[model samples]
Target: MINENVSIALVHYPAMDKEGKLIVTSFTTMDLHDIARPARAYEVRSFYIVQPIDAQRLVIKRQIDYWLSEEGRAANPTRYEIVQLVRLKYTLEEVVEDIERERGKKPILVGTDARKYHKTIGYAELKREIEDREREFLIVFGTGYGLPPDLMRTFEYILEPVYGAGDWNHLSVRNAVAIILDRLFSKNRC
Candidate 1:
């Protein structure tokens, strides 16, 4: 994919079959399951793109600082190999590119704005980039702040951004997720 906006680290090859369309990098509305596992109250969303994202600055935290992963002594076993924690650290395109080098083959993506990782809605652009893979969506969210504005953009016809409650201007990934699940599973049909 030779997007003029793509990071310089990723080779801009013309070989990519799809281009010119919006490549979403966040979770889709269809991915909202009913928390079937129940082992964890909240599964921090992990962002992924099908195509190679030039996210050299996306600092993907490999450690878990949360109470469960850190201090908790309880048996937090998982049947699906759920990660202990998934954290996000946004930075300049250059920084995200660095992340790409650090996390090879693990899937690195690019960004456009810096909205502080607001919500999954902002991750639309990230999701579109890799929708064809048909993998499950687990968007690791930002801790202190939220995703930046540049990260969020709806996918093309193949997959568009999943919009939930709250306006785009001010929405948290956790809140967006809560709203999404509520609307998706809400039985109240008046």
Candidate 2:
């Protein structure tokens, strides 16, 4: 399954602030819930949340623990199932290492941003490559002002920025995940 070969990472560190300075952004509970729902729906193999801060990672771990508990399952079985897709990592390198361990091959790194990069690949072209290739893909998303240029350069391909009708390009990482997953995996896409 194509979806099974795809994974996503919501990166909070090495991101840019509004002024374009690199910073670590905090993750919200909503980000976990909203993004996981779509990822599970698409049957993505895994969803990694990358945060360098130990404190933030603990908070996320606690939440995940609850969601996986019997009480949490009783409270919301659907969410319990979805939450299982999430994996916490202290760095993007950790994410790559984990994926490589699980799949026995390094995933093709794809970055996401509101601004286009020189290596930007269109959705259609990316979809074709994903279908044609045998390797797994990890689509990395940045929070705050988006990923820093140095980090962006590490990716093999940066997906074309998602554009609406207007010039405003800012999109919540959760919303972008949902939209990108739909674009890449939806069975009824037009």
Candidate 3:
């Protein structure tokens, strides 16, 4: 788990609405705790919440502060410890920049969507690629309607969709994050 080559970014801006129009979604404090917990459990180097709105950032900062406060820590020290991995960023570019600053090179940005993209890679293959390439990666997940093609196109890798027997495959952002992280890092994969 010491690879230190993997990070996750939950993108709120430049995301699409139900009507397919690009918009910036409001930040949700729930997603912060949910995603950060698993990201920490899986030994992810960092978890970035990418939101552009100033007010939203302030709210997120307050929530983060509360989580780190002595009272908050006393309420649930384990939770506070995991949440300490969360970092707030204004945009995906900033996430990349921070990753580069820490790792000494830009991460291989990867996007995740509910639908398969032309050059998408499977979970198993992606696991191998990460190990073989020995490079840092920033796995990006979008909000509504999933990540648009243009935004997805910027990623060096795209993960294949996770589906079940039925046609329905839409999952909440945090749920998808947990599933994707398990697929990428779970040791039981065979």
RMSD of each: 13.4, 1.0, 1.3
Q: TM-score of the candidate numbered 3?
A: 0.95
lDDT ranking, high to low: 2, 3, 1
1 or 3, greater by lDDT: 3
Comparing 2 and 3 on TM-score, the stronger one: 2
| True-vs-predicted CA distance for residue 100, candidate 2, Å | 0.6
- The 10 consecutive residues of candidate 2 with the worst lDDT sum are 1-10
Question: Judged by TM-score relative to the true structure, which candidate is superior, 1 or 3?
Answer: 3
Task: List runs of model 3 lying over 4 Å from the truth.
Answer: 1-3
The numbered model that scores best in TM-score is 2
**Candidate 3: tens digits of C-alpha lDDT, residues 123-186:** 8888887777578889999987777779988888899987878978999999999999888887
Lowest summed lDDT over 10 consecutive residues: which window, candidate 3? 125-134
Worst 10 residues of 1 by lDDT: 8-17
- Report clash pairs, candidate 2: none
44-84 per-residue lDDT for model 1 (tens digits): 23322222333421212212232225333244444123333
Record all residue pairs in model 3 with backbone atoms less than 3 Å apart, i.e. clashing: none
Q: Estimate each model's TM-score.
A: 0.29, 0.97, 0.95
